[model samples]
Target: MENKTPIIALVDDDKVFQLTASRTIKAAQLTDKILQFENGEDALVFLKNHASDSETLPDYIFLDINMPYVDGWMFLEDYSLFKTKLSKPIEIYMVSSSIDPRDVDRARNNENVRQYIIKPVTREKFIELLGKAAA
Candidate 1:
């Protein structure tokens, strides 16, 4: 078997969060490839287009709950429909600023979501999550 660097996707509408999180991931040296999407729709399209391409498919996705279009829940709904077609398994983490219990509980209930993370994820946390995925 060959070791392959994991690819990460950041799906969020917040530009600041995207920039900061990407920088943090880079600083942690988690992955050299990072995909950015402004909303779930875009992420979904990307995933669909690359469903059979393991090299292009992301190993992990950091999803935001709120966005202009296709929020995290909506994304998960659609993703579940076609996830089996994907060439590789992708771990999804719900990363949101909303600390609402309802939001957390809803995400936790979703089968596709591996974890629900609060906003402003620390570099160490990113390392831990990505490291686990890579492992």
Candidate 2:
């Protein structure tokens, strides 16, 4: 049998965070395919375009709350509308720097969001999240 690696998407406006997180994810060796999006709008477009292509869709998404074009909340709102059309289930984790209770509550309440993870996720956390997704 061939081994299928999980694809991960990092949707955030922070270039530094994207670079650091990508490095951490790479070090974990959970997957080699990492997609980067500067905002939720681009990520949403990608998801929509690949809705029927499981091979091209990401298995996991790390979404940031604040962004220029489209925020995480907005992305989730749009995503919920067409989630059922996706060929494969995508686990979305709301990774934000915001510590506001409202933000946490909102993310936790979203059915599409797998979990709300705080920003600057450690290498161990990346492994844990990716391992869970891979499994």
Candidate 3:
């Protein structure tokens, strides 16, 4: 869906980080819808409704694990509920500053996840991931 164009979403509570990342994505000339959500619940709601009929369910989703309303794990669980519900695979990456081994393991083992990235994701890093996906 989404007119076959890439959709990039940033799910983070920090205003500074959100702004920085948004700017980075824009400056890179990736040129896509840079959607932002303060919490996982909000992102999940949009995903469940609008993206269900759409195909490009976030070509790249940067998800922050620590949030008040719904953490990243909770979001992942909520997202998993949509089994066979959509046409596109909403690729996800666990983006956070948490160093807890458990969180890393969980993200690594999750079937829907692509990778676990640290906070303040650099533009170069995201571009690298984008290259991987493109390749």
Task: Give me the candidate number with maximum lDDT.
Answer: 1
Question: What is residue 101's positional error in candidate 1, in angstroms?
Answer: 0.6
Per-residue lDDT of candidate 1, residues 13-131 (tens digit): 99999999999999888877999999999999999999999999998999999998799899999999999999999999999999999999999999999999998999999988888
Q: Which pairs of residues collide in model 3?
A: 1-55, 1-56
The lDDT values for all models are 0.94, 0.92, 0.83
TM-score for each model: 0.97, 0.95, 0.90
lDDT of 3: 0.83
Q: Quick one: ranking by TM-score, best first?
A: 1, 2, 3
Clashes of 3: 2
**Collision count for each candidate, in order:** 0, 0, 2
After superposing candidate 3 on the true structure, give the runs of residues whose Cα lies further than 4 Å from its correct spot: 1-4
RMSD of each: 0.8, 1.2, 2.3
Candidate 2, residue 3: lDDT: 61
- Tens digits of per-residue lDDT for model 3, 41-131: 9998888777666554677788999998998999989888883586676679889999899999999999888999988789998778776
